[model samples]
Target: MSPAFNLETCARPNILALEPYRCARDDYKDDGSNVLLDANENAYGPPLADAVSLTSAAADAGLDLLGLHRYPDPHQGDLKEQLCALRNTHAHTAQTLTPANLFVGVGSDEAVDALLRCFCVPGRDRILVCPPTYGMYGVSAQVNDVGLVKVPLTPAPEFGIDVPAVLAALDAAVAAPDYDVKVVYLCSPGNPTGAALRKDDIAAVLGHATFNGIVVVDEAYVDFVADQRTASLAEWVLEWPNLVVMQTLSKAFGMAGIRLGAAFCAAPVARLLNALKAPYNIASPTSTLARSVLGPAGLAAMQANRAKLVAQRERLIEALPQIPGVGRLRGGTDSNFLLYEMLNSSGEPDNAVALAVYTKLAEQRGVVVRFRGKEHGCLGCLRITVGTEDEVSRFLEALAKTLAEVRQ
Candidate 1:
């Protein structure tokens, strides 16, 4: 069947109506030369730092490499081959991921945008996403004119996944006659909540989508989970064509600056994404850096970082709750970020208290954190990205002082 769903009937009417931006053929294919023609990239030296070296705290991390004079591989062939081994999910069972099954974007953020562009019709079509999760999901949906149906995560049992509620949303969307559940976005080890979706919950959603639709499991933070191997749904996508597992090199591999990310799915889904994506979605340097990072040494380093982050997270779990006014600290079993709720001024549950604490940390302690607000079951909550031991200690010290001030 052709992928031509209703452009108007789906979401992002604005996107469908507007002419898509097109790139010339030369923009994507690189013949490997000193001079470049294609996307009018600034004829200049590479940045100050290498992809790996860029992560260090050093100020001048970019290195001006001369290879900037060429186009990147539009298909991302090498990167996909490496990802296949890393993901442990070969395309044809025996192998062959090929350029057909993969599309590389600036980052996973771009992958999410591409997914919306391909599947969502905008303005007419609708998507279902859980809140207290990634805001980008909603933003990307809106950008594509796709309507969002939010079923927020429940905050009470420590921001537990409201599986029944999500299922109900799906059922309602399907029954509405006007809407079909085009995509279900689940963030395991959800942001702010710092808890992974129960495997059963994932299975149920995948089953539902397999029978009647599509579900995209985003494992962006999966590497931080204690059991990283099980935190992803990459393998399942092979069994369920409707499943699209999205991942990025940003979190674990520490390649956020390079902006490289990938989506794993059946060839058909990959085709749709490719057709919708810009010809040269990934930069040449980005691919080169990604290739270097996805090798054995890079993967090992990522695993080591994950191990260190997990250890630090566990340390926080034990040390954070001891501070007064901290109602709870939730983490582990999935994800590197942590969620800490603060006791209200009235000694009751309060997201405001948490917000105030986050503010104090940034303003007074000069510590930055992403506040999830009360929207996604993280009422009175703060999402702290795990850092080095020294950084964590600094945070804890400031946090202790902040809590003391708040309590009094």
Candidate 2:
């Protein structure tokens, strides 16, 4: 008595039109020999001493071999407990966070996807984003059939969010009554931008009288920031129930391969994300490695590595502008990368010159950096990840040579 469903028509139209997120490896297939400064991965691998210590401890605790046969804990209580303790170090108030405030996922990408699913209804709800930021926010919105309202950051203030403009956009959406703005994504220590949004500006958005939606701040590169208070807003979750702060172990912990991310939010939102995620979302092997890196010894080693990377970032800032065809550096120096313009013979942004340098660096010199000229406000730009001392030296050499060849 039942009619058969047509799979093609059943598929959401928005998803049908969506293009997949192009990861670094998708564009350039690394044979493991190239100097990769394209993606914002830490050139220095995880701390060996702490890794060894963790392996020994896991072995003694009988957890080293357990992952092969058993499913990972659905609750991921142990890892959550460790994160809770670590986060309390910068607690905004005397109040401490518990596992109820946390949601663990494969990565922040999953958290972003889950939040949209939990809040936005297909073709009915909308989300707000500031441009020249993370690509995942827009990509996830497209996949979910949600409308995106963009209020680009004011270029004058060095890529700072235009809080008043965002408020006005939300009001306009409400007056029209066309779509409900269910979520707002903010990336601090932003990708490509390499800037941190001021705390007061973020609070202004969270405290908006008209917008009752959740504000998710992606702090993936927060670990690279020298000041912990400026770098993180996780503690603010207590004061602002609508706030959610997302972080990852991929950057500072050098565990991109592990694919673990954490979100700190109010209990209700955390519960919803958990409900929407796959039952066994975090794999056993991934959880084991995550726990090891989050343990006491591992935390200390991570801090040591962070100190080194921060130094390298500063060194790059000092030396990069000296190169030929390099123009003004944009945004704040909070993250592990820099976004600077590549100029031409006449000293203006030249996309052609930038592209040629990018191609030559990768193809001829085996040094790959990202060409971001196409992004909003990023004309003739190349976003380079801060690498090891040797890598930086090599990058400078290759860049100088490439610039000369391209200009000629």
What C-alpha lDDT do the candidate models reach, one value each? 0.71, 0.80
Candidate 1 structure, TM-score to reference: 0.83
| Residue range 197-241, candidate 2, lDDT tens digits | 888888888777766578899999988877775467776677677
Report the C-alpha lDDT of model 1 over 259-376, residue by residue, as the tens digit: 9888887776776676667777787667767877888877788788878988998898888888777776644446777776778667665766677788899999999887665565
Error of 2 at 231 (Å): 2.5
Native-referenced Cα lDDT, model 1: 0.71
Clashes by residue pair, model 2: none
**Model 1, C-alpha of 51: deviation from truth (Å):** 18
Choose the strongest candidate by lDDT: 2
* Per-model TM values vs. the true structure: 0.83, 0.84
Clash statistics: count for each candidate = 31, 0
On TM-score, the candidate that comes out on top is 2
